[model samples]
Target: MSKLSLAETAELSMLLEVSANIKPGNIDRFHDYEDTKFRHFLASAVLARDVFERVPQMTLGEAMYAAVEHTNGHTGGNTHFGAFILLLPLIKGKGIAGACEAVLRTTVEDAVRFYQAFGKTQVRVNREDEMDVNDPASITMLREKQMTMLDVMRYSSETDMVAREWTNGFALTRKAADILKEKDGADQIQEMFLRLMAAYPDTFIAKKFGYARAVSVMERAQLVRAGGLSLSRFDEECILGGVNPGSLADICIAGIFTALLEGWQWDC
Candidate 1:
């Protein structure tokens, strides 16, 4: 088999993440949120191909904003905004350690552009006290404080998993990639997703439903992992309660991309 290009690997990661079945609280082949359908995710992934391909020519912030723009044009909602945040750095830096260093080098202009991209998405983010992404005024604050994208990530790292990836050298994402490489078959994605949810309190769920609820979700994932809870039951409960662990999904996509880049086969 031919080696997949960076863009192809990135795009395939998005597609594979969403297509993985029985992903609790997420849009997958068998489930869809009312507003953001599975087809919307598919569209966003396909549309993002060009953006990923263009990453080398754009700054991290530029690539992120462009990706959100492309996704918004087709999906009519935020599907891959978080995924773009994770994937863009990895694609640009070409490896986990390289991505970490790349994020640290981001400029104030990158933070400004990232804010612009945040405005394009309806993603529910945990806001920092000083620079709220939802507020247009935060852009002025970002510039005044001279906060680079790395600075912004550090501020939000405590409450946001995606931002934490930026500050922590993509530790969880790299660990997830290792899990993917160690596992096999189509079930690998679902298994990795469950394991991640079991281990980490998904900040996306925390931001919307409170940290306590997020912990409960993680505990339930642990039960599922241990065979005490059913995967379908967990999926139904999350869907019924509107608990979407989107940040973990983004991380999973990054892991998938990383695994693919390292020549993990798509045998399933």
Candidate 2:
């Protein structure tokens, strides 16, 4: 855990590379991509049973349980150590723990990249002169509220500065969630999507399904809110089936909550 394996390092490296080139409009797309990647990883884990069949002493369940618990902050709960023992054979050629670490580390990198990219897009700085003001000392003062276009105009800043000013202080995660929580959040989130579909009206269409599937999950878990949203049921099913949740942001938020609940303190 102290030394990230090659795969883990590669995943983090990819994240850092993407962070440098992030743009405002790419945030959502990036999140969607990460979510897909994570789901794929989980699926792979569940489907690798054949590879472990030859290892008589290895236990896949124990290994997977350990990986999930370690991530979920349930430290020392080797309840399923047998599964990991079973998985030992699959990773035998590549060090079972190392491979598992790599997969988990990749998830961590995706989480970082998703948020960092969002943060980068929110802030912009165009001119050389504005570079001086981009210092952490100055930026910290602005990370509070939404920097509006009008506010940028008043500052006489460069186009980049205006963009940066508008987003420099933006908190993408909270803002995205808030956007959903607000009176028109869902409509707004769905609106852009609808508009896009309208523009391509002749595209392949699917039957419209109500939120019935989602609602059922919320109801069974007693997580329904008068106004709040819950994916508890969906998430539970996904977890049991080794599937990813609806979005990267959702997965990241789940990790955060798990970490928080398990008292795993981090600077974040």
Candidate 3:
């Protein structure tokens, strides 16, 4: 068994993902947004420890809501909202694929609670017409339609990377965990982040900007991987453009948690 408890692993994953340098546009040890500082993320991660510890005992929706509630108490803005969404199910299911799938088979109550959680964050999300999470009426619609959390995820999957993870059995998160297994040291996390950014147009960027800009970010990442673009320059452009790839960062946290749970050591 891993030495770290599930909560500890989850906390470490959040810490590691945020502290990893050169993450481009996202706050890290070396970068910070005006409103959301690196220390805010640290505070949010620390505050989330108890919530993660309680995840196994809580329903998925309750866990998510609790996490956002706890984290929001410390941070001025959203910090780990997306991370909680991805990590709670994994923690509840103990990182087993089948168990995780079972955790995702949510209830109508789960959808309601998840929307309640969504209201806590300033995290930008793609809006759905029928069941927009930002709309107060959506909660009633969720009940009338009897949509489960998974159903909401399915509806948003095409435009939301986090939702895609829910609908697609967390394929990217699991794959990232597998990739981390092959890497050796703290820098490996940065490498994994870059690779993920290169492959996928970050949905957070897409939501904030446009699909074309999101694709441009991916292409720039590919250039960075191919040694054609300087990492620093890319980071500068993204920060200047307010093109934060937050969805990928959230997955990176979940991936790191899965890796740590499976005995991947943090050499740093």
| Candidate closest to the true structure, highest lDDT | 1
* TM per prediction: 0.96, 0.19, 0.95
Winner on TM-score between 1 and 2 is 1
- lDDT per residue (tens digit) for residues 198-261 in model 2: 2211101110112343234324333323324333442344344332112222212222222222
Order the candidates by TM-score, highest first — what do you get? 1, 3, 2
Question: Of 1 and 2, which scores higher on lDDT?
Answer: 1
**Per-model lDDT:** 0.89, 0.28, 0.87
Candidate 3, 1-268: lDDT as tens digits: 3478888989999999999988988999999888889999999988999998898788898988888888885545888888888888888888858536755678999989999998878878655556767889999999999999888888889988987888787889987888888876778898899999999999889888889999999999999999999999999999999999999999999999888888787784
TM-score quality measure for candidate 3: 0.95
Rank all candidate structures by their lDDT, best first, as comma-separated numbers: 1, 3, 2
With candidate 3 superimposed using the best TM-score fit, by how many Å does residue 184's alpha carbon deviate from the native?
Answer: 2.3
Give residue 265's lDDT in candidate 1 (0 to 100).
74
